[model samples]
Target: MKKLIILILVQVLFTLGFFSISNAQAPKKKQILLIGTFHFNNPGADAVKTDDFDVTTIAAQQELEKITNQIKKFNPNKIFVEWEYYDQKNLDSLYQLYIHNQYESYVEKNFKNKGNYDMYVQNEIFQLAFRAAKKTGLKQVNGMDYPLPMPFDTVMNAIHAAKQDDVMAEISAYTSGMAKEANLKRKTMGLTALIVDLNTEKARKINSGFYIKTLNRAGQTDNFGGAFSVAEWYKRNLYMYSIVQKQIQSSDQRAVILLGSGHVAIIKKFIEDEGLYEVVELKDIMKIK
Candidate 1:
């Protein structure tokens, strides 16, 4: 009877010890910083370089420095950049091709010739980010851009539907609020504002129904253009968010996402909605600082 009592006590102690060890080994959650940047141009300079869409401005440069300082302060474990779904080899190949003026040979043919086409958002952001990331040794830049695998017509139809549903207006208002807070308007605001202003006129037309037949007819022909224009921006942000989440799970490192202002806003909203992450918006932190 004494021996049996001793055995039972030992078994209970072992079970308790196992539970404690399991609890201790559980993985920890990470905090992420989602920062929105304006590419050294003021936040709303969307049409400055119509041919090339250059948005490099004095304010943008200043903003870049500020961003760099913040990243240094945070020192996140990983960094995500706006990129495509290509392997490192393919990415390197693309980079080399662009450098060698051969990017047109295989991918995105005539989409925008580097030589004749003006550098727009991607060019502006990548130049600054690649330089900073290299200098700071934050070498893990992931490309989250998709090649838009649908026909232009299909995309246009989707945009048309989105416009009809007031989705474009919603995006515009969200972007405008951020731009107003920044107090530095540039093409980013211009693009969204254009959409918003047009949609307001549109909403008015629908509500007032002034020449409804003629207006609806005209809208049917010219509709969806504006919506399609902004679709890439919206989709890209979601792609970026997904890639960032994947990176977070793949490694035990916190990530910092440096994307356009429009992207950061939506991504932040989505991340907050997930209720799984502890996200710090640079805007809030800046206010506190």
Candidate 2:
């Protein structure tokens, strides 16, 4: 009995020691600073379009500078933008020009439009991420965007076939109105406040609600199109999260991703679900906490 008792004690000690080493050897989670933003240069291509306010004005430029400075203080090792993943080389080229202070001159000389720096001046990637990258002296802003078929129109057509015009109209009006209201607020609200608001739980829920609740209720039977479309949307976010995870290196302490609010909603959920990284809220960095 004494020998058996001693063996049991020895086993427990070994188990505890093994676990201790395992815990100690585990890598610390890298931090992710996710900033959800409006498309600064609205191309009127989104499902819901708003008249985007200009970021080129002197006052607007100053506000952007303040916001960019806050991002700089995040001290991100990498800055990820929403450009397509396949377009990283092009993005790197543009970023190289911006960092070298020759982006505007190159545009003027090559594009035949001297004053038109819309791509450089009026994009959140150029306005915020590029500026932040330059401040941090990073080599390139990463392009982690991967697009998938959202198929909103097919879902709408299915809803229409199902005689759910009212539901369709309800969803449409609500989303479009939200965009208009945001656009109006942007005209008056400082860019930081607008961005913080865009990343909040309240805002994220509305974006999620479009796929998970509003549209999902619109169809029946063979026309489970809402379910199908939302699935595609979720899949896209999952793939995007995979793209983001692939960019993480063992040496990277933290990275920043500036993406649209709609994408932010699902990817944030992915981060929470996967337990891979510590998320630094945009609000906290901006001191809105």
Candidate maximizing TM-score? 2
lDDT tens per residue, model 2, 120-226: 56889988888889988899899888888678888888888899878888887987898788878987887778888889899899888877777787686777888
For model 2 the TM-score comes to 0.86
**TM-score of each model, paired residue for residue:** 0.48, 0.86
Specify the poorest-scoring 10-residue window by lDDT in model 1. Answer: 210-219
Estimate candidate 2's alpha-carbon lDDT, on a 0 to 1 scale.
Answer: 0.84
Q: In angstroms, how far off is 186's CA in candidate 1?
A: 3.9
lDDT of each: 0.51, 0.84
Cα displacement (Å) at residue 81, model 1 = 1.9
Tens digit of per-residue lDDT, candidate 1, span 106-194 = 44555455542433333533455554454456645556554443233444455466454454344345445544543443344542232
